[model samples]
Target: MNRFLLVILFLFFALGAFAMGQKAVVNLDEYLLSNTKSGYTNVMVEDMVFSWKLQGQDIFVKIFAPLEGWLAIGFDPAEKMKGADYIIGIISNGAPMINEHYGDNPYGHKSIVLLGGKDLTGNKEGLENKDGTMIGFSIPQDPQDNFHKKLLPGSTHKVILAYGADKNMKARHAKRYIIEIKL
Candidate 1:
């Protein structure tokens, strides 16, 4: 009787596992056929573009621009940005991180935040919140530590206003305005 009982238990567990496998197969098929962006709630497939903004603009989600300040940008983490990249224009610095066209490319890396029901493909370089909000400042790869320190944890703005840098590692000679983000 004990052996019979053991056989029954084993069969029950095997049936449960089989049921789970069937459910997984159904969900996978639905995901690939679905059109709505699930915010990456499903699998971690590569090379998909998702975009959102803090404030709406023709370009990226535009942030605050000031006469005596700099451009700051922020966005939501719900956007699945697997293949997307960002480009930030600066008011200061010659943009050593510029592209072949000598244009500023601040977000050359993937900046997707995986909160708010999203999964991460690659880690982004900035502050991320559990609810999928991201804040990033457009600065050169080698900037004064003061600049980075200024963008510490609780800062409300993401970009700054200033002038472009000169050949001497100083942004004192050029007028720079514009922070562009490519999705």
Candidate 2:
């Protein structure tokens, strides 16, 4: 009878530990949703949510869209898409990937590395779930690149938010918008 009781207690503790572990693993969508009230300025455009916070010399950004494809944000364009600095995040091959890009013309963009510019992207993360896709990343306020613009805290700038319908980066955006935001 004592051995039986011991076995029951061990199983109970094991199950409790397993449950705790599951709770400890955070869902990316839940984390991004929680940040809406946590020092992040959130903007809702259509079905997308753009959130950002400036901390020290770096700006942290999070984007949540109801798509399973790629999401991107462009900082200050010259004309149309010309001379814009873009950061794109996608879940490729079941993993998160980020790439820095430069708008070379009025209608298109290419990778910054391919354009002979240094990559300025900081830590990036992406996740795709039943609800949607979420991407979070960080970039310096002053990237010191010709194609990128300085993001001053008190300045207002034009930002472009776009997302595709699939994971193909070369595909056209399913939806895009331009908005003026004060950093």
Candidate 3:
């Protein structure tokens, strides 16, 4: 099908889902193509096109990227991808996993801890595609210290994007991309 048709269909289902309590993950490809005149700057890194929107004192973050292995988005870390607050996701054994990690320097304190949700990794909510998977979650404007730092509005935060991080051992993100944004 044509891209336009795909996006229209996506919006249809997504709107229905939103009516139910859960919001939908906006596909990166479709969003970029449709919103050519958007106010937000384009944030496409590697195979991932980051999409974000503000709603009710919360910021919704989504990563639509092909998962050859895994993809991650880190917030305010000590280094590029070190000692950061991360939302890491992957398909492990046919099961989709979105994990919340607290990054510690020297790669020794990487812990899979809770990020203020019942599930450590903000619920597994997103869409999957042949090109890649769209893994998404949300963070409050003002988060607790467990998330490493407070994310207040009008403040800028630096995030590192990485693909193919080793899941078994301490996460070492490859093909890392770093960028800063203001909420």
Candidate closest to the true structure, highest TM-score: 2
Instruction: List, residue by residue over 1-183, the lDDT tens digit for candidate 3.
Output: 999999999999999887785434446656676434443345777666776665565666777566546777788888545667777777665566777777655453354543343223443665544456666677666666555556676778887777763444244556678888886
* 32 Cα displacement, candidate 2 (Å): 5.9
Model 3: pairs clashing at backbone N, Cα or C within 3 Å? 66-132, 83-103
Give the candidate number with the greatest lDDT.
Answer: 2
lDDT ranking from best to worst?
2, 3, 1
Which ranges of candidate 2 are over 4 A from the true structure? 1-33
lDDT tens digits, residues 18-83, model 1?
887652221323433341242221212121112322222122121212122222222211122112
Cα-based RMSD of candidate 3: 10.0
Clashes of 1: 16
Can you tell me which runs of candidate 1 are displaced by over 4 Å? 14-28, 36-103, 106-183
TM-score, each model?
Answer: 0.20, 0.81, 0.66
Candidate 2 achieves a global lDDT of 0.84
